[model samples]
Target: MLLAALIGAAGAVGAAPAAEPNTQVPAGSRHYAASGFPDRIVASPAQDAGSGFAVAWRTAPLAQPPLLELAVAGDSPDMGQVQQLRASSQALQTENGDSQHHRVLIDGLQADTLYAYRVQGQGSWSAWQHFRTAAAAGEPLTVLYFGDTQNKNLSHVSRVIRQGWQSAPDARLTLFAGDLVSGGDGEDDNEWGEWFAAGGWLLPGMAVAPAAGNHEYFEEFEDTPQERRVLGKHWPVTFALPSNGAAATASTTYWFDYQGLRVVVLDGTSALDLGTAKAQASWLEKVLEDSAQAWNIVVVHQPLYPLRAERDSSVLASEIRPVLQRHKVDLVLQGHDHTYGRRADDGASLPQYISSVAGPKQYRLSPQARATMKPTAEDTQLFQVLRLDDKGLRYEARTATGRLYDAFQISRDAQGGKRFSEVTEGRIPQRDCPRPVSPKGRDDRCWE
Candidate 1:
C-alpha cells in the first residue's frame, strides 16, 4: 500500500465515533469559528472557457463589503499594481454563527496566463494565491474525482482529499461527486467547517466542480415532522457554479467547459419531482445537443443504477438514462451509495458509469449488490484520477495510502465510438470489512 493509502478509512475504522449525523454545532466547535481571517475560500469555473474564473470565501459577521484584489503575473507580479474589486455578498445564519459569504467573478482574463489574487475581510487581507487559466483545446489534462466525502471531515476525510491532491498536483480541476458534508441543511456548521479545513489551501488553488448528493439536501430543521428534503440553504452561498442548467436546479444543477471536456452536473434530488425531472431531462438533452467539446460527462448525486442490494433509484434512472444514452456521455460519476461500483452501458458503447465513496462511513455488500456490480468494494474509501489524452481517457482508483484498487481505460475511435477496457495491472483485490474485535460491531462487517 502507498503511504497515502495508510491514512484514512482503512486505518480510521478504530478511531472515535464520527460526529452525529444531525450535529449542526459539534462540541468545541467554537474553536473552528471564523475570525477576521477569510476561510472556506474556493475557486470555481467562470461561465466560459478562458476569459474568467470565480472565487468565494467567508468572513466574520462584522466583516462587511467583501473585496478581491487581482493582478496578472508575468515573470513576477507587483503587488502594488493589483486591481481591486468589491465582491457581491450575502448574509447567512447557521448554527455556527452569523457570517457573510462573498463571491467575485474576475472576468476578461487572458487564457493560459498566471494570475495572483487575494480576498479581504473587514480589516484583514488573505495571503496572495495564484492559479493558471485554461488553455485551448487538445491540451492533455488530468482531473481528480472524489466520491461522498461526508464524514469525520476535519480529521479523517480531509486527508483523503489532501492525499489525492498530493498524488495529482498538476490536475487541472477536482470533481467532487457530492455528499460533501454529512448534513447539508446548515444544521451542522462543523461539517462544513471541517470540509473547508480538510482542503486547507487546496480549495482555492484548484477549481472544484461538485455535484449535490442527498446529504447536501436535508429537511430545513431536524425537528420538522414529515418535511420534504430540499437543497440546503448553504449551497447557494457556498458555491458559485454556472447557471446554465435547468431553472429549477440552477447552481446545483449546472455545467462548465474546460479545454475540450464539457462537464454537466444535475440535481438528482429534484428528479423526484415529476415536473422538475422532465425539465432537467429536457435541459440535459438540449445541453448535450449543443455541446461541441470532444468529451461530455454527467455528474449527479444518486446513482441511476443503485449499488446497494435493497435500494434502487429507478424513477430517477427512468427519467435521466435516456438523455444520457441519447447524448452518448463519455462517463457518468455518482455518489450516495456509500460503496464502489462500475458498470458499462448496456450497449457497451455508451457511458461508463461509476459510483464511489470517500469518507470514513462504510457499507456492506450483499449478494444482490455483488451480482449487479462487476467491480465493487465495501468498507473502503477511495479516490480516482483520470487522465485525458489524445487517444482516450485513463482512470485509476487508489486508496488513501496510494494503493491502486481499480483501473480501466476508455478508448475513443475515429468514428466517435468508445471502447472500454479494464486495466487489471497493479489493481488490488476488492476489500471487505475485517472481522471486528467487538461482537457489537458485527453489523459493520463487509463479509459475513
Candidate 2:
C-alpha cells in the first residue's frame, strides 16, 4: 500500500519524457551533485520510539551490495565490535542523472542509547555519525524547528540550520514544516542536492520529521489539459519516515512519539488541494485521541490562519482546526507564508499557531497578523528551538545570525489547561516593511 501510494503520487503529476544526458547543471551546485560517493544521508525515527531508527542516503548505482556498520558508542576510539547490516537500494532517474537511493532500518536496540553508524559508498565508507535514541517516556527533551527553506538553501538557509544546531546542540529531533526546496517539478535534483549540502552532517546526526508543502507538488507539464500536480521524486527517496499515517497520504503524513511528546506531521498540500482532507482529519482525530504522551504538537506546511492577506487556507481552517481544538492540541508549527507570525492560544480553545520562514524569501504580514500576532516580522529569516518537559514548554525564535528575536513559554495547570506568556526582555525590535507614500507601487515595496 505504501509503495502504491508513492507511485500514485509521483505518476499523478504527469509522466516525463526520457531525460537528455546533457542537462545543464547549475553553477556552485556541482559539488553537491550525486556521485559514486554517498551523500544526502538522513536519519529518521522509527515507529518504535526508543528502540529503533532508520537512515537513508544517495549514491550512484552500486556495483556491490551496500552495507551499514553499526555499534554502540564507547569511550574507545576503536569500534570494538560492529554489526554489518545489508541495505536495500532503489534506482531513481532524475533530470541530473541516474542514482541509487539506499535505506537501512535498525531495530531491537536498547532504549535511550547512543549508536554510531556509517554507510558503504562505492569503494570507501562514510565517516561514522552518532545519533541517540529517544529517552524514556516523560523525560525532558529539546527540539529544533524551521519554517520553509524553499529558496537559497545552499547560500542563505544553510546558516540558519547550522545556527539552529548550535543553539540547541542536544536537540533530539529537527522538525521541518515543509517546502525544503523550491522546485515544484520533481526533476529538480540540483535543488535537492543543495538542500542536503546545506544541512551537512547534522541531518544524519539528528532524527528528522518533515511535512509536505505545496511547492513539493508541481505539474510536470504546465499549461496543458493533462497537467496535474504530483509529488516530487526526491521526496520519497530523501527521507525515510514512519508509515503510520493516513493510508492515502502514506509516508508524507505520519506521527511519532519522542520523549513524552507526540509529534504529528500532516500533509496539508495533499489534504487541502489533493482531496485527502477528510482522510487526514479523521486520522488526526484518532491520533490525538489515543496519544499517551505528556504533550501533543502538530507540524504542517500550510498555516490554518495565513499570515498574508491574499492567502487563504480555508479548507485546512475548516476541516483540521476543529479536530485540533476538540483535542486541545498544545502547539502547531507551520510554514508557507514566507513571513513570521506567532499567535498564542486564546482564552477559549485555539492552539498556539506559528508561521515562520527560514529562507531568504519574505512576505508582508496581513492585517489579521498585525492585529492578532504581538510581534510579527517581515523580511527576516528565523529559526526556532523548542524545549519540552514536565515543567512546561519554552520556545525561542532566533534570526539567521543567531540573535534572539522572540521568546515565549507555555505552562499547563493541574487540569491540563495551557497558559501562554511572552518573554520580551532581551528580544530584538520587531521588523516590518514601511508603508509606501505612493500607494500605486506599494506591492513592490516589500518582499512579494
Candidate 3:
C-alpha cells in the first residue's frame, strides 16, 4: 500500500479516548483558533438540484452586514468573471459560538451548466466559488466521502482530503460526515487551517457538504465572553447551500437530487438523538416518500447502525434508519465513529470502525466486544471513494494512500431493489473493531 493509503483507512489508528490523560495537551487547546479562518464556505456540495443551488459561509465577529454576489463561472476558470447579481446575510448565536452567515439564491441558470460565484463581507469580498445546477434529467456523477478529520487537524488533515480530490479530480461534490472540528471547548480550531488546506483551492474548486458531528458542538465549555457571543457562526458564514432542501431552513439538514440520485441530509444531532428527532423523523419520512430520484442517499453526524455495541445505535436508527430501509435508500454516509467504515447493503453493519487524528498514525483496536468482535493486529488506515455511472454504483473503502480496501457495486433490478456485487481492493479478509467500548457518555447538553 502507498504511504498515503497506509495513512488513511488501511493504516492502523489508536482509539481517541477523550481526556486521554495527556499532560502535554491542554483542554480543547487544539481548536482555540478555529474561528480565525478568513472564511467558512458551504455550497450545495451534494449533486445539483433542478433550477437552483445553495451557497453559505461564515464571517467572524459579525460582518458589519454580511453580503454575497452570485454569478456564472467563466469557462476557463479565468474567463467569465462572475457578475454580482444580489446578496444577503444573517447573524446566529448558538450554544457553541457566534457568527454571521450569508446565503444567496440564483435562478435562470441553464441545466448542466457550471455557475461560479463570490461573496462580499465587511472589509472584503471573496474570490469566486462555483457550482452547477441539477440536470433536468439526472446523470451519473462522482462524489468523495471523508469519515472524521477532526483530530489533530492542521495541514495533515488537508492531506487526507486532498488525496480524495487528486483521485477524483472531477467529482461532483465532497461529502463530509462531520466532526469538522473538535467541539469540546473549541479545541478543534487549530485544525481549521488544515480543513481549508484539504480543500485547498478545491473548497471553492468544488462544493463541500459537512454534517454537524458531535464534536461540532460548543457545550458550555466556558462562560467566557467569546464563547457565549458566538454559536454556529463559523459554519454558516463559511459555506452556502440550497435554501429549499429541508423545510428550506438554514440549518445543515435538507435534501437535494443530482440526476437520478437523491441526497438527504439530517441533523443527526437534531433528528437522531437530540430533541429534533420527532420533527426530523417526520421530515425524513416525507422527504424519502416524496423523492422522485432513482438513487437515494442519507447523511448525518452519527451512525444509524453503529458497529460497536459499546456505543448505542446512533439516534438515527430509532429515529431515522427505518425510514431509509422503508424508502430503500441506496447509500448511508456518516463520520462520528472516526474509523472509516461502510455497509455493502442495508443489512447489519460491519463491526469495523476507525477513529484517528489527521496526521500519520498507527491503528490500534479498542477493547474487544466479544470473542467474535476483536480487531486483527493487522489493521489498515481506511477511507472511501464512490462512483456512480450509467450501469450501476461503485463504493470503495480505501486507505489514505489510494489502495482499495473493501469494494461493493450495486445495480438496479427491475423490482427496484439493488443487486449488489461486492469486491475488495486486495485479497484480504474483513476485520472487526472491538464491540462499542463504553459510551463516550456525552450528554445532550451542547445540542440543547
RMSD of each: 4.6, 10.3, 7.8
Give the local distance difference test score of model 3: 0.57
Candidate 2 per-residue lDDT, tens place, 1-448, comes to 9988987876754444222121234544444456878888999998766988999998988986699999999888899899999988888887667889999989898889999999988887888999899988768899999999987687778999999988888898999999998884433687788788788888999998889898888875679877767998778888888879899899689998888889999999888777898899999999999997778999999998888887878999888999998988888999999889988556653478989999876778888879988678988889999998866888899999888999888887767667867788889998886544212344632542
* Candidates 1 and 2 compared by lDDT, better number: 2
Off by over 4 Å in 1: 1-28, 62-64, 74-77, 184-187, 220-226, 273-275, 436-448
Model 1, span 238-322: residue lDDT tens: 8777767798777678888887788989888778732478888888998899988878889888888887666667777788998
Off by over 4 Å in 3: 1-38, 45-50, 58-71, 75-82, 91-101, 121-125, 136-138, 186-189, 221-233, 244-250, 344-381, 413-417, 425-448
Candidate 3 lDDT score at position 199: 61
Ranking by TM-score: 1, 2, 3
| lDDT over C-alpha atoms for residue 112 of model 3 | 77
Candidate 3 lDDT over 224-253, as tens digits, reads 644331234455555565444455224667
User: What TM-score would every model get versus the actual structure?
Assistant: 0.90, 0.89, 0.73
The TM-score between candidate 2 and the true structure equals 0.89
